[model samples]
Target: MTQPNDGPPQGGFGAPQDPPPGGFGAPTPPPADPLGKQPPAASPIPPPPGGYGSPPTPPPPGGYGAPQAAPPGQPPQNPAYGYPQAPPPGQPPTQPGYGFPQGQQPPTQPGYGFPQAPPPGGPGMAPQQGYGYPTAPMQPQYPGPQQGGGKKFTTQMQIIVAAAVAVVLIVGGGIFYASSGSDEKGKQGEASSAGTGGEAKGGEGAGLDGGTEKAPADTKSKVGFQLPHPKVTDTTTVHGSWVTDKAYVKTGVYEIVGYDLAKGTKLWSVPLTGQLCAASRHMSKDYKTAIAFQDGKPSAEDKYPSCTQIGALDLATGKLMWSKSVTSAASGDEPIRFGEVTLSGTTVAAGGTSGGAAFNLANGAELWKPKADANNCYDMGYGGGDALAVVRKCGTYDNRQLTIQALNPSTGAPLSSYDMPPGVEYASIVSTKPLVVAADVGDTAGDGSSISDFFSIDAATGKLIVRISADADKYAGDCGSTEVEQCGSLAVGNNKLYVPTEEHDGGGEFGDTNEIVAFDLTTGKLVGGRADAGDDYTLTPLRMDGSNVIAYKQPPYDKGGQVVSIDGSTFEETVLMVNPDDEAIRDAETSFSFDYAEFIYEKGRLFISEKMVSEPRDPSNSLDDKQYLVVSFTTV
Candidate 1:
């Protein structure tokens, strides 16, 4: 089973409660303020409605102490505290009123069947210990002294199964897919795995009852339901497993409970702490060390409101190795995310609210503080073993422009940085080896119909390598907007770039149609990709050990983005999340998992979130979503 993929969001859903008449796709804007600024030190601003970001004021003893029994006849609920739920995939509400697939559902009816916090068992609800996502825990045993390029790490290659493609005539036209078996029935069981009712103490097959029970000594405490979606509370590379349950280290107040990817067993829970704003964790190229981001309150200075730091965690014991704070005045609310942290040779770099910084990977010390004009920018793509590639936004209001930059990982040196050519924006750096590919994102039409425009970047010097476009803008379903050319998705592998295009339309107004165009990295020519597979195909290239494995979301269903992949000549898209039960899925023939966790593709396998569930008879029964599954992938 899986758990809700994201920790509860701050600010309580922060969107208009009502759905649009046009059917979904509501645009949620970036915060009025950018992220990552030094907090005001003099006097303090009154805390916001939600208890987030406010500097912690000492409460009288026992104020928010442990939970106690409610007085007699009390409802036993805390109305003052209601944590927010995670907005669905792509966190789309932020891009509201724009390019969206018809029939695609919006955030569930605000309080969708689960309580915000009172009944307990929320995804990040650890005991007193906390859990956070993206960054791995501060485990010890990480390496040391990363002042210069001391070493370079590389992984072995991996291989995966090949996918079988077939064509199906749907409403608009014919489409082809690699219908590998991704269990549709089990998807139902996925959502139903947690938070259906108030019954947290019940055993397996425990019907949704409001009664709360304690857990067995040998087993975990009685399981309480959490939000149906699996939250990515905290991720740390464990001993051979790479990623293990947060519970392995410290416990927290409330935690996300879900299945184990390797054994399919239920872990007690994953924790979420208020300290961490956002995070990212990954192993070194050589697999000898690990690096991560920690968006937390400053550990050194109380005068500093909150800070973002880089930390190294031991792969074996889950102990802290070292950590260094990233000081910047860009903004006060910078968001750190998955894939935001990268390790190059011996140096580590992380993107901030507007720019990126390089750090000593082993010691968490600052190697170089490189700056650029990226407004509210946070993720990055790397190329040329020694350089870091980034995109940043500059200026303010309407005059604002976003630009991409490349910096030498060592010596905190500048290599090349410039404004992305117009007509092309929000580009994603796809690869660095055979070639460096970057994607630009823009929106067209009244809504955001986006596309991915590919560019060849010089690997060593970070220059404009080349512009490779198969005229995707000419495609009929291109949505006619410049954004389509700017924001489409592209995957690079085997010296080829797989650029998915919006070919045909189906269902409501727009469709989830995805087409891939492969480009030869060396020749900059159109190399054949899944050209035969129509728009319905969704693909991502991954590296296992060393080989390339292409992962795809299975078809023959609606909505759920379940995955199946082909490693190479061998194929297998049929393998999907196993069913926990039918109640998890609501009425869809092909079972579906809740859209919560973020996806990270690496080493020939994919890692996705898993969740767990329940349904209650009592009106006020369910806990906010909990876990039933944890998203994890692999290749043969």
Candidate 2:
């Protein structure tokens, strides 16, 4: 299905971007076979419910062999688009960590949807429906023609059918669903959280003054690791706040901040980054010895944000263990960015904005770097271990072609690669079972709006394990587009794959009715009918705890968002509060919308960020003010 020659494109979740509007700049392969190549995916992810037309296209093995051990030369540096320079040597590198979840916050109802949110209670603003693209000015007069195909509905047209509808609890522009959990878990298996951090004053995020600047999620979400409350204007690694007692670290911003549930102080504010720095500029996760996320991206250049230095500092003292740069020779003058610099055991696996590299985090030494076709490789996220998933141009949907690389996270040795889905600029989402989830658009005819078929690739060996399709027509009716915008977040947790879709015809950028659906990892069958999020819903895939999956969604039509809990067995729903004052907030009938949606079930909470969308720019007001929503829910 690699009609890479397909039409228009669309497509980031976080960290970096591919070649800009024009042609993709040439890329450099890792020196010394930098990242070792990986086994190719043997199969393709099955098309979603409404199966798509084509299958995935497995890209060839790593184009370039690991680069030869470079001569003792200085690491390459990036030319700045515009930013401060790094400190001289003997100085710490920059820190990178925009850990905050992106999403708009709540405000007094002015008849407008969520607006510039303050810390707790910001200023009052007029509420009016914001800018949105409406396809059908008035609902199409003719009834949808009866049609049937194997493809699951992209999002069936307004069916004349109805579920148990009710006066959904609406308060403070938040929609409250009759959230209920399994009898076994009681209310424990409920929705999201901000993180392992203290709460900010409600009005702390008043800096932005426009509407919500929301973009679809990047493919870097964890299997329930809720992010922190992030801001809209966050340029550098805008790492948002975590839940109470949870700790998160950053490299460029080079600071690890989180709340110590036991102590309650600003847990540990280790000074990882020095003065001038950028976010996600440089950093790596040290999940082996201590539960710390480290950074060294302050020294990252604009182009290569992910290209960074490394230092296993004393979690307590922030003292350096051994500082070394994760450098690569320049193939072309193109700069690079990075996904979360992952540290498995002590090895570091990072996807340079342009490509990716793996190094021995223990000695600050380079292990291996994988080479890519010039301008072929783009940003990729890790699925733990020696596996890295990436994307690029393909069939339709900007040809969101995702390729999974099972490399030696330490030596960058070639393990295997996955068969890539045929599409453009797609992302490889984080997976728990050495699997890679991707957005694959099949033969989309009418418009490039809806996604035909979304795929899930096996990371171990590039192969198609399952295909979640929304490709063809249905007896109910035809769906809207072949884009994944229908689903807010796509992730896997608690042995279940979670996908949330939004159908906002005239609501806003990603506005529409929200639906959160879960699928069995082994089998592509859905857990239950997608949980309804009302007219519009935003979804966040959360981490998993015992037998349950944590997730959250935002309700459209002036409805605040709420967290949800799904019973692995029963697929029940429970609403939790990411923001504190849960009982009080619920009493006040507060709701929310998240920019970055994901749950950190490992820590029992959900995280979200609020940012202002600029591209599909708002007509009336420019979404300036952005706030974050962080909450946690537990099994009853």
Candidate 3:
């Protein structure tokens, strides 16, 4: 169930309000000219037949609009007001009529009275047949005066006859124009109605049959489908769950496998060989390529490695595009670690222990590497735009200072550099334009509570603009121990930031209620108020899609879960779709003590993968005989 924000009641789907007066289908007013401009001044001539001046008086006996009995031997006069006497009892009913004589059909051709087809290729040529009424006898034509000085005087009868003809044309054209406009408006109305049929109702999912009926069968069947898993040998284990729109799993000690999202179909797999340490994978936006970090082999007995390797793979074919080995100056026992891999325009970057490296995404050619300086310039990868961000630790562990730098993605040239305020440790880059940097600022209020602050810096000069404390009352709360990993638990959206809040006191369990607090990305100010996750459910902000936040609702162990949409502006909640209940899914959480299911949203669908326990479980590993079930819930 979803809750609608309190507001004024809206109109129901009963009878639609009538169109505004004088609009479509209203009594035909004086029609405009053929060019759709205003009508000209009233014509001096009398109106045409059935027009305003000639107000359709009852027809005389035996005339067009009146019925008449036939004489002793002749057939009854044709009922001119309706269909033409049913085509003399045997013939076809001559072009089905609607209260009009078949011969007097509505104007199909352009010209006046009882329209007839135009001549084959010529414009406006009169047809062979005239109006259905009797044709006047041909009259003699008189020659006009010769070009001499003698002027020819116009006759009064001639002027009157000409004016009458003009009136007929004007009135007839007016009627046609009005009728055409009416018909067009009717068609437009029908199209508008059909187009809005799938529009979402108040607080309900669109395309869900007015939000009353369940989603279609095809959508429901997408849930609980199996996803392809890599074969685990003695040296392999699942490294990551989702990479872009596909899944990546470790197939060998140094090999990774990629699978399609919908069906567990294997797409490609690649193996890494001869590296210093374990390899880590990163994917591109299109999922067509991936970058991995390969540590260099250390010298005999020397703990620090002098070289590091970066490898790129073509995900479509599982072939290595290229690999580059770079010189490293690290000389300590601590192993080098890698950060995020990001793609910016035509450049691909990977950040790691020594520093960061930029390479051409298409050819994997090394574009630039960090300089060998005491600053230890380590690349943090590219952010929102073409700006690449890096961090350098300046002081020792007790009083460390992080210097943040913004560089051009294409050339790795430094754009701006500034050291963060004292005592603030750089966590991760949240965005680029404002250079939002998340930092862990010491513990707050004892009780093992650590405070994380988000700083918005000017990207052009690296000047501190605003600082938003994530644990302050304005934000959600203190980032719990587990949530404060690489960066304070926060998700960045366009112009907004979402921070998770623990509704329960301790924040260690799955079923506890959790809410999300939003903040303005530029101003570091709270957006709206706190968005609660209902009574007993946990609401985890998964991702932001346009103006809506996609969140998941996890009910208690045995109950079902639902995917919900929250309006980013209003914080109104709408349940998009519900996931089916599986005892195995619940038991995996309660009994085997597995983490909650994982889900990814791509396009308009949510893909969820949950571990399912098999009947015969291995004692050594809980996941030994277990398989993962993949399911999808669409907007419908």
- Model 3 lDDT per residue over 1-636, tens place: 110111101111110111111111111322232112122113212122112211111112221111234578865443322233366766644443221213444454332223346558687655533221112211111212211101111122222332342232111110110121122112221211100000000111211222222233342322424443324322111223344534533232345556665554667766665321212222454554434433422245532332244556556556777766554344243222333355555676665434566788778777886554554334433442334566655443344566777778778887887677554433456544435666544322111122345666666776655555442211222222211112223444445566655333112212234466676645444554545565445566664544566666655545555666666667777666555567654333223211223455444456554322223344589666454434444543
Report the poorest 10 consecutive residues by lDDT, candidate 3: 193-202
Q: Count clashes in each candidate, considering only residues at least 3 apart in sequence or on different chains.
A: 153, 201, 2
Off by over 4 Å in 3: 1-222, 227-237, 241-253, 274-285, 293-307, 329-340, 374-387, 397-399, 443-451, 472-489, 505-511, 588-598, 608-636
Tell me the deviation in Å of residue 128 in model 1: 68
Q: What's the TM-score of every candidate structure?
A: 0.45, 0.48, 0.53
Superposed by TM-score, candidate 1 places the C-alpha of residue 48 at a distance from the truth, in angstroms, of 40
Which clashing pairs does model 3 show? 224-631, 228-264
Pick the winner on lDDT between candidates 1 and 2.
2
Score candidate 2 by lDDT.
0.32
TM accuracy, model 3 = 0.53
Worst 10 residues of 2 by lDDT: 164-173
User: In candidate 3, residue 424 scores what lDDT?
Assistant: 46
* Better-scoring candidate (TM-score), 2 or 3: 3
How much lDDT does each candidate structure score?
0.30, 0.32, 0.40
lDDT of 2 at 127: 26
Q: What does candidate 2's lDDT look like per residue over 301-391, in tens digits?
A: 4221222343454443344566444434433432233334444556655543334555555565766654544434433444342233333
TM-score, candidate 1, is: 0.45
